[model samples]
Target chain A: MLEGILTGLSTATMPVNLFMVFIGCFVGTFIGMLPGLGPISAIALMIPITYGLDPASGIILMAGVYYGAIFGGSTSSILINAPGCSGTVVTAFDGYPLAQKGQAGKALALAAYASFTGGTISAVFLLVAAPALASVSLSFQSADYFALMVLGLSAVAAFSGKGNILKALMMTVLGLMISTIGTDRSSGVDRFTFGRMDLVDGISFLLLAMATFALAEALMSVLKPEDNGEADEDAMRNLGSMKLNKEEIKEVAPVIARSSVLGFFVGVLPGAGATIAAFLAYGFERNLAKAKEKLKFGLGSLKGLAAPEAANNAASSGSFVPLLTLGIPGSGTTAIMLGALISYGIQPGPRLFLDNPEVFWSVIISMYVGNIVLLILNLPLIPYISRLLAVPRQVLVPMILLFSITGVYLVSFNSADILIMVIITVLAIVLRLLDFPLAPLLLGFILGGMLEDNLRRALLISDGGYSFIWERPITLTIFCITLFVLVAPLASGMWKKYRKKTVGYGASMQE
Target chain B: MTISRDQIAGLVFLVFSLAYGFYATDIALLPGEEFEPINARTMPYVLSGLGAALSFFFVLASWRSAGTLKPLKLGLMAWPPVIALLVVMVIYGLILNWLGFVVSTALFLIAGFRIMGERRPKILFGVSIPFVAISWFCLTQLLDIYLAPGRLFSLLGG
Candidate 1:
């Protein structure tokens, strides 16, 4: 294990690989700085570029973008009250208020340091935990894997959007249905291609990603431009020193440490990602604080600045665990990363440790390098980086559209793919307009193939006995967990209503 | 006549699911595998049936919840720019071979910028031209991928 780690470090340090890391971070920061763009789109846009490179370099570059974008997301949150990504939404709650108080530099500094610390800590956890988990999963059978995939799909229904779990679950089912659109490998028979030659390969991952994230996002902005607030000139003038005083450091370090550990664990769960981690950390800190200190939350507390900033960055790293060990992506951005891995002909799973140790370790080590590169780039250059908010949407949106078109075209040099991209983009826009969550759709699509394969394999092993699922302890436990996750939300909602009603009755009695 | 977004979504998906389920039945099993418990068609049928049932439930839920409310409809003024952008993109995709990468991209950008309310033609031409040139150079030269020069470029003849 030590030798593998050292080998990964050496490979990541090579000149070409190191250069790709720098480029990924730089571009990722810019992408994250853009108001309407997020890490998912940034990663998607880079997929075509990574096509020609070696697997290690390709993944290193994409991973760099993932972390760099998170770091850059805090810049927009603090300066403009526009979190460049969803994960940075909680950061803006107090981050912007701090900027308004002439503490922009302090807020940004705390964010930078906290992000670095959290990321580095999470990477260490990943380095230790992923391998251990992978070895354990190596003992898993087909039944166990199918149950695990079911758990993953169910968790998406639990964690996505606030409106309706039923709606999310339906979208997931639709995604799975869409995944059935090509030739079945075992049967050599077409399933749902509808006789189109293009459908033989099923849908292209890049095309779907570009349409859903980049193109759909641009079109939505055009339909109704977001009211992204501008940075305050007065606050810009008081862009105070980036240095944290000793007192501030003493207060923030422990919060950063606590949130990093907390966020990493949250991120390790399927369907939960940075946004949940950030909110959890923020709430945890507020609840733990004394009354007077608690009042400072959402009102520019330094602890507020540190908690979510650290947690979200840590959570991004934490989300990598299941992707590496189980071959199931825990979030939307990681789903795209999983797609990139598969595109390179590398299968990610328990056997990845034995079959493709180089790909796994190098990506793991690149996170360490990426976090350092982001901290160094963001701390001093933050003031300038925030200026990206001022770029006109007319210019930025058009350029992004061009890149989406060209990137998809370059993958196969086929204009037919471009047409398919446009059609999908239109479908994505209609779905977004109706408030259908795209993340579940994407999660369903990515995991569906593996789910079907495992289901079939398990049944074959059992000679068509469905009892094998419950017969196996591992599979049974996973199904139980899935049932709990799905039911917990409904149970909690009812409990909250019950508590509210009882409290209301008590108040009426007193009156 | 006035359906909520959720209702429309549910109806569309429900119809889609039924079609998917019906079509999946036609997927033939591998030779001598007809008696197999799980085959290629099994997952698709199960998934589509579940999808159809869930979508039906969704439609009923939305209809029940939405007793009498509707979001303000988008005014006619809200759509031209978006429609124009989409149209320009379709045209651009159609013209790329005939007019080539540089020409079509430049034209698309100019139209796109104008439609988005960028009024200055100088700024429009300046940004669009340089962008197309640089991207063309990067993809064709640095990346060593070919972007067609177009029929127009061929007609011009060096």
Candidate 2:
């Protein structure tokens, strides 16, 4: 393992690899600075560009984009209360408030530092944990994988929050249904093609993702008015001198450490991703902090800002574990990476370690280097990047819309894809207006095919018995944990309500 | 906007999916292998069932939550971009087969810039033409992805 780590570092030190790292970070920061453009879109846009490159170089560049985008996302969120990506939404909770308080520079600096610490530590964890996980994954049968996918889907629903449980389930079901739109893989007979040649193959996940995220977001941005004079000029002036005091650092350091560990673990779980990790980390930090004194969490609390910033960056690194080890993507960004890998004929699985150790380890090594590079870039470049918020929304939204359409069209070279983009974008707009969570919809689309494939294969192997999920200890353990995550919240919420009612009744009787 | 809209859409999708699922089951030819009884239709049928259940859930939920609907504000200025996109897509679709890659993209970008309120025609043409040329070279000349070459471009041995 030690030798492998050294080997990985040596490969990453090559000039070509180093140059790719810089290019990826530069492109990633630019993409990440753009509102509503996340690592997924950036990577998706670049997949065709990487198609001609070597596999290791391609993977390293993409990994650099992924981690660098996480760092860049914090800048927009802190500056303008606009989360450049879903993972950075929690950062905006406290980050924008800090910006409002004229401490944008300090918040940004701390964010970069915390991101660096979280990312480096998590990369080390990934190096240690991925090989062990890969070894264990070697034992996993089709049944175990099937159970695991179900657990992943259920966990997405559970973590999607309580208000949207039914909608999330519906979206997951819809995604699974969409996954079956092509010809039957085993039977070689058309299933839901409706006699169209294009339908012979299923709808592309990339197309669906672009439609849902990029197209939908662009449309939504157009519908929203441009911010003309929201931010205070006085606050902007004060930002020139903003810096974190020593006392603030002493308070935030432990929270960052704890959240980093917590976020990494949450990210290791399939379908949870960085957003949930950040939220959970923030919740943990808030609950653990001094309760007697009212801590201004959600309003420029340094701990609140640091916890999620650290957690999400760690989560970004943690998410790569399943993708590299088991060929499962833990988030939307990783799913796009998986798609890009497949397009390059590089199948990511347990055999990846033996077959392409350089590809695996070099990409991992680039992640560490990418994080350090981003820290340097973000700390000094915050003011410049923050200036992006001053651009008129009218000008920006149209350009984004134009690029989105062009990008989607360029990828498939199919007119039908453009039409699909419009349809999905409209659907997304309606869904968003209805208050449905878009992340669950995306999570569903991603895991739907894998879940269907694995479930069918498992049943075939088990000879149609449903008992396979319970027979395997690993599968059963995952199922139990999934059940716990789902049921725990409902049970606790009911219990709390019950206690409150009883206490009220007792008080009335005493009165 | 109404519970009926949600219910109707859900029911329509449910029926469509059910029909498709049944048709798919009939079309699918199961293997004669002794080891496994499950076939391709099993997963589709399962998904169909889930879809049907969710459609019903949507109907129920929309009914129960009907009163909770809030008024949504729409920005009027947003319509122009949507219309512009629609227009660009139509134009692209129409020209892609005839005008091909370079000409179509340049025209599209130029028109797109104008529609988005860029008034400097010189800048528009200058920026767009080179972009189209580069995209043409990269996609067709280098990567070997077949793009439709314009009739005019073909005269130049494209």
Candidate 3:
């Protein structure tokens, strides 16, 4: 493990890799500061640029971007009360109130510190957890893999907000269906190409990612024009002394520590991502607070701010565990990363541990560096980066659209791809409007080929009896978990209802 | 009954799945492949069935659930510029083969800016021209990715 860490340190410290990380963080911060764009879109936009680099550097760059984007999201949340992504939505609860109280600097500084601590601790945990899980998953058979995929999909659907589960599952099915468009990998026969050569390779992951995330998000902003309101340009200029007194630090220190642990564990769950982690951590901290301090939660409580900031960053690191070890993405952003990794011809499963230890370890090491970079480099630049928010929507929107389409165009240089992207974007926008969760579709699409492949192998091993699922204890355990995940939402909803009736707006509803 | 957004999406997915299932049969299987445990059609068949069932339940879940079901809010959107932007994107795709990267991308950017209400010619050409030039230079010169000159240029040169 020490040797592997040294190897990772060497690769991560390489001039080019370090430069890529810097560039990724810079670009990611910029993109993420925008009100509408999220980390998934930010990473998707960067995917084209990473194609020119080696896999290790590429992944390192992406990891930096993921952290940068989250940090950047927190900045906007603090300065303007407009979170760049869902993960940072909770950051705004206390952060914006701090900004309003002329403590914007303190809030920003606290966020950076909390993020740094969370990222560092979770990186340590990931270092231990990822390899341990990798060693165990190394023994995963085709049946086990198929069951894991099922669990990943089910968990995603189950956690996709209260009413969105069915919609999310439908979108997952839709994504899986879309994945069958081109030639079947195992059979060497076309499935739904309809005699089109473009369909021969099916849809490129880049195109779908760009369309659904970057392009669709850009267009949806234009289409719907969400009124997130605006930030006071003057308030941003003077962020009011970015310093934390000893007492302030002492107060939030324990909160940050606790949230980091909570966030890491939640992130390790198959479908729970940073957004849920931040929300959970914030809720947890609020519950722990006394009545007076609890009242300050939505009104610039340092503990409230620190808790989510730490948890979200820690959860970001924890989410990588499933991606690195199990090859199942815990979140939508990682799903895009998984796609990019596969495109690099490097599958990110247990085999990745042996075949590309450098890629695995370097990512873990670089995450720590990424967190440090976010703190040292980005904290000071928040004032200037926030100024970028003033850039005319007219210019920025077009530029983003151009990047989104050009990203796909540069890859295949095919004109038809742009058309397909637009069509998909249209469909995606409609679905978005309909409130069908797009992440599951993306996750399902990414896992679609693998799921089918594993199922086929499992069936083949079982001689078409479907017994491989139940015969293997590991596979059965995973399938049982999947089933439990599917039923959990209904059961929880019922419990909540019963509790509400009996307890009369119980403590559960308070947080 | 007035259909909600959920019902609409469900119905559309249901139809799409049926069509997909119908087309799955047309996928040519090898002589002995069908007799095998799974073929190219098997996954598609399963997906189609799942999609149909899921969409069916989705429809049923929304059926008469009026309190929670959001009515489609299509009228709230500013459709003209969005539709115009879509047209601009499609046109950009069409013209790219003829005009190549620089010209088509410039036009796309210009149109996008314009649709989004940017009328200043200076800003339009200023951003698009320099941006395209740098991007083109980077791709062709620095990166060594060959982007052929537009068909019109090729024809004229010949």
Candidate 4:
């Protein structure tokens, strides 16, 4: 094990790997600072460049971008109310309010520290959990994998919330349908190529991801004119000058630790990405606070800022475990990585460990190095990034839209992809206007292919026997967990409504 | 504030998807005798069925919640961009093979910018020229990805 660790470290320390790490972090931070761009878009844009590099270096660069982007996301949330990405939405709860109060400096400092803490702690967890999970996955048959995919899909449904259950289900189904657009994997027959030669290999996950998330977001931003008042004179203050008091540090440290653990677990769950983890962490933190104390949450509670910041970063790290071990992606970013790995002739499974220990362990070591580098880079640079808030929305929006168009077009050099992007963008705009959540749609799109592939594979193995779903202990356990997740929320909501009715009746009788 | 629009759209999408799945299943040839009967199309069919059922449920739910479902009000700027995107996409689809990436993309970007109300000729030329140049160089020269430089550009040694 020690020899393996040393080998990994030596490989990651090479100048090429180091340079890619910096480049990824630098590009990631800038992209994350852009209000509408996310890691998905950043990765999509960068994938074209990676075609020229070695697989390890390419992977390292992408990883750097991923971690850097997450950290950079907090800059916008802190300086302005706008979160650059969904994962940073929780940061905006406290971050923007602090900026408004002329303590943007303090909030920015605390956010950086909290991010570092969360990322480092989660990196440690990943180091421990990933190898352990990979070992356990060595024992998994096709049956176990099939069950895991079902669990992943069901978990997405549960996390999607009951209010838009149908839409979420529809999105999931649509995703599965879209995944079937290329040639049949098991058979040589064309499924839905529609005589288009470009689609014979299937709709690239990279393109679909860009369309669903990046282009859709850019369109949404364009349709709704953003309030530029956030960039008013007060936004220009330097955040580096501020320091967190010892008391503030003490208050947030526990929150960071608790959220780090919570975030790691949330990330480990398929379909529950950083946004949900952060939101869940904030809700938990709020409940722990007093009623009056809760007032500080969205208005710059240190814990509020720390919890989600920690959780989201941890979730980001945790997302890789399933992808690396089980060959299943827990989030869209990881899904794209999975696609990239496959494109590079590297199949991510149990054999990934036995066949390529250097690839697996080196990637892990690089993540740790990336986290440390991000901390060092972001701490001093907070003030500089905070200045990004001053860029006018008029200018910024146009630039972002241009980048989106260019980026999407660059991916496949296909005009058809641009059209698909535009259509999805319009759909997203319409959906947003109607108050439907976009995250679930994205979640569905990411998981749809996995769910379809696994369900059929499982059935093929079982020979249409329903008993296989229950007979496998792991499958049964996952199914039960999914059932619990689905039913628990509805039960709690109904109980609350029932309690309210009873209380109202008692009040009427008293009157 | 017709709730039916949502339901109808959902139903149409669901039905089309189901048809597509059935068609896919019909075309799919199974693997070797070593494998079971279930093939690639089975899961798609299952998902399509689930989608159709969910769409029906959505319609029912919309009807049940009619009293509570709020009317959707779109912004003023919404329709123009949507229509422009649709029209441009159709046109681009047709002209892409004929005109190639350079001519098509320039026209698309310029028109898109105009639609967004950037009327300054200097701004238009400024953004358009650099965008075309950089995109061409990066995609063609740096990355080595083959882009359709159009018949006109091909004649000029593109």
Candidate 5:
């Protein structure tokens, strides 16, 4: 472990990697400050640029962007009451109120402090946790892997909130269906090309990511046109003192610690990610608060703003655990990173650290470095970054549109890809309107090939019998977990319904 | 008689799955490969069934809540710009081969800016052309990447 840390320190401290981290954070902050472009889209936009670099630098750049974007989102949420990403939505609840109260600088400062602590703490926890998990998972077999992918896919839907469970699952199925479009690698059999040569490769992950996320999101935002930057400009003029006196620090200290720990654990869950982590931490803090403090939560309580800022950052750090150890991305943002890592020809799984120590440890170390850079660099630069983001949507949106399309075209040099991207963008916009979660679709598409390969291997090993599912204890345990994850939600929902009926019947009897 | 948005989604997916399943049968398999435990046909068959089943359940669930669920409504969302932008993107795609990277991208950005109500020729021409030129330079000179010259240029050169 010490040796690995040293390896990471050496790689991450290199001038180029450090520069990548800086550039990533700056760009990430800029993009994340833009309403409607979340970390996923930010990361997606970087995919093309990162294609020119080495794997470690590429990933380092992305990790920095991920953290920077989250921090930037909080900036928007505080200053303008418009959250740049879902993870920072909770930040705005208290943050915007604080900004309105002439404590915009304080809110920004506190959010930055919370994020730095959260990121640093979780990076430490990850330093200990990731290697242990990777070593254990090194023994994962085909059956176990198949079960794990299913669990990951199911968890995405199960955790995608209440009404969209079925829709998310449908998207997952659609993703899988799309994944089967190209020829089958194992048997050399063409499946769904429909005689089109472009169809043979199915779809490019970069293109899908760019289209569905960057292009679709940019276009989707265009559907509801933005104001002429008046609100942002107004908010920028009065930024109050950034200093947090001893009293303010003391008040939020425990909240930050509690939320950071809670956020890390939630982020370690397969699909919970940072948004849920921030929400959970906010709720938990509110519930723990005294009556007076509780009332102050949405009215700009220091603790309230600090709690989510800390938690979301911690959760963001915790998310990388699965990506490194299990090769399953915890959320849509990480899913795109997973796709990028795969394109770099580096399979990030149990073998990640063992095979690519520089890549692995460098990423982990760069995350911590990225956090420091954000605090020392971006916090002070927020006002300027926000102003830059005020570039009118008329100009900004088209530039983003240009980048989104050209990003794909440059990679393949195929004009047809541009056309295909248009189709996918339209489909993505329609699906977004219909309220289908597209993350699962991307995750499913990414995992589809691996899932099929594992299942096929498991079947072949068992002589075509399904017994391997139950035969291997590891596989059985994973499948059981998947079953629980899938069934528990429905069972609990039904139980609630039954309880409601019984309660209603008793009320009727009394009447 | 009002099919909710969820129902429409479900119905579309259901039809897609059925069509996908139909096509799954047409996938060519090596002789004796079909007997294998898992082949090209295996995943498609499973995916189609899963897709069909999920969509069927989704449609049924939506239908069960027919009165409660809202019908599909996209009227409030601004349509002209979205439609224009999408068309602009499609045209951008078409013109790339004919006009090359610099001209087509510049045109696309200018047009996109115009559609979004940026009428100032200064902002439009000034931003689009220079940006495209810089990018073209970066790709061609810095990255040493080849952006194919326009087809018209190629014809002239030949």
Candidate 6:
């Protein structure tokens, strides 16, 4: 393990890799600070650009963008109460209040420190944990692999979105069907291409990503033109000292430490990401605070600001575990990263350690480098980064649209790809309007090919025996878990109703 | 009976699954692999079947529910503008090869900004021109990828 870490550090030290990380973080922070743009779109737009680079460089760049966005998001949340990213929404609850109280600098500094600490702690956990877990899966057979994939898809569908589980499952199935297009691998024949030559290669991951996330998000912004009503240019002054005194540090240190552990574990789970971690950490801290000081929480308490900041950053690192070790993404952003990895002809899974240890380790080491860089960029430069909030949607939207188009064209050099992207974008916008969560659809799309390939391979090993799904112990255990995950919510919902009815009946008899 | 959003979504998925299932049946198996336990058509068949069942479940869940769905509020700048923007994007994609990156991007941005209510011509050109120019230079020079220089440039014999 130590040797692998050293090897990774050396790989990450390459000048090109280092430069990509810096540039990615800088650009990611700049774009991610915009009100409507987030880490996903920022990384999505960069995917085409990274096509010209090596796999390690591309992965490094994307990781930097992910971390940078988390850092940049806190700036807007603190200064203007508008979270630049979804994960930062919890930060804005108390961060903006601190800014209102003339401690914008203090709030921003606390966020930078907490984010750095949480991220680094999680990075340590990832370094120690992912390899150990991957080693266990190294012995997994095809049946076990297929069962694990099913478990992953089920967890994501059940937990990621707050909407109806049936809808998420339907979307997951739809994504699986979409993956079946083009050629049937086993038969060596086209299945659903409908005679279009381009469909022979199946749909490009770039097109699906851009259409669902970047262009769809851009089109939705155009349609709604969400009122950026919270940005108050007048309150942008008096960013008091960025330095946190010893006493203030003492107050937030434990909160950051506790939340880092909580956030990292939640992140390791499929379907739970930084957004949930942040909210959970914040609520936990609120409950921990004293009654007299509790009221100060949402009104500018430093502890309130630190908890979510720490958790969200930690959660981002935690989410990488499943993607790297299991080849299953825990969240939407990581799902995009999984797609990026596959585009480079690198399949991420348990064998990733043995097959591409350099890529795995370098990516892990780069997180340490990226977090330190983010802390440096965020501390003193935050005041200026906040000015980015003033950029209007009208100006930003068209530019994003142009970038998406140009980027897609540059990747394929085919005009048809761009048209397809636009069409998919329109369809995605309609889906979004109807409140169908797009993330699960994306996760499904990414995992579908692997799921089918493994399922078939497992059956081939069994000589067409269908009973291996439950006959193999490991596979059976995973299937049982998937089954429990699917039914748990309904079971719990019914249990609560039954308890409530029984209690009501008992009370009436007493009366 | 009025359909809710979930019902509409369910219907869409149901129709798509039925169509997909029908298509899966016609996919031919590989030679000598006809009796194979698991073949190319297996997963798609399973997924389509699952999709049909799930969508039916969704429709049933939505059907027995009793709450008012949120009214679709197409605010001030609504459907017409959105539809118009989509048309503009489609046109931009169509002319991109002919008009070149610079010209097409410029025209798209100008039209897009105008439709989104950017009335200031100065700010419009100021942002659009520099962005288009820099991105073109980076793609062509830095990345060594070619963007179509357009018919006008070709006609000028550059």
Best-fitting candidate, measured by DockQ?
A: 5
Per-model CA lDDT versus the true structure? 0.86, 0.75, 0.90, 0.73, 0.90, 0.84
**Model 6, which residues run further than 4 Å from truth?**
A504-511, B75-77, B151-158
lDDT of 3 by residue, A1-511 (tens): 8998999999999999988888788888888888778999999999998899999999999999999899989988898888989999999999999988889999999999999999999999999999999999999999999999999988988886447688889888888999988989897899889999988999998999999999888888788775544344656888999999999999999999999999999999989989899999999999999988998989899999999999999999999999999999988999999999999999999999899999999999999888888888888988888888788888998899889888888889899999999999999888888778888989999999999999999999999888997898988899999999998887897899898787865665775
Model 6, position B73, has a per-residue lDDT of 75
Off by over 4 Å in 5: A226-232, B70-73
- The residue pairs found clashing in candidate 2 are none
Worst-scoring 10-residue span by lDDT in model 2 chain A: A228-237
Q: Please write out the lDDT profile of model 6 over residues B9-74, one tens digit for every residue.
A: 888889989999998888777786668877778888898899999999888888876255677775
Which pairs clash (backbone N, Cα, C closer than 3 Å) in model 5? none
How big is the RMSD of model 1? 2.3
Q: Report the lDDT of model 4 for residue A78.
A: 80
Per-model TM values vs. the true structure:
0.95, 0.89, 0.97, 0.89, 0.98, 0.95
Candidate 1: which stretches are off by over 4 Å?
A228-238, A498-511, B1-3, B67-73, B76-78, B151-158
TM-score of chain B of 6: 0.86
Residues B35-149 of candidate 5 have per-residue lDDT tens digits of 8888898898999999999999989888877787554457878899999999999998998998899889999999999999999999999999899899999999998889888
TM-score of chain B of 1: 0.84
True C-alpha contacts between chains kept, each model in order:
0.67, 0.51, 0.81, 0.53, 0.88, 0.74
Model 4 global lDDT (CA atoms, 0 to 1):
0.73
Docking class of 5: high
Which wins on TM-score, candidate 1 or candidate 3? 3
Point to the candidate with the largest TM-score: 5
Sequence-dependent TM-score of model 4: 0.89
Better of 1 and 6 by DockQ: 6
Give per-residue CA lDDT, model 6, range A317-369, as digits (tens): 99999889988888889989999999999999998988998999999999999
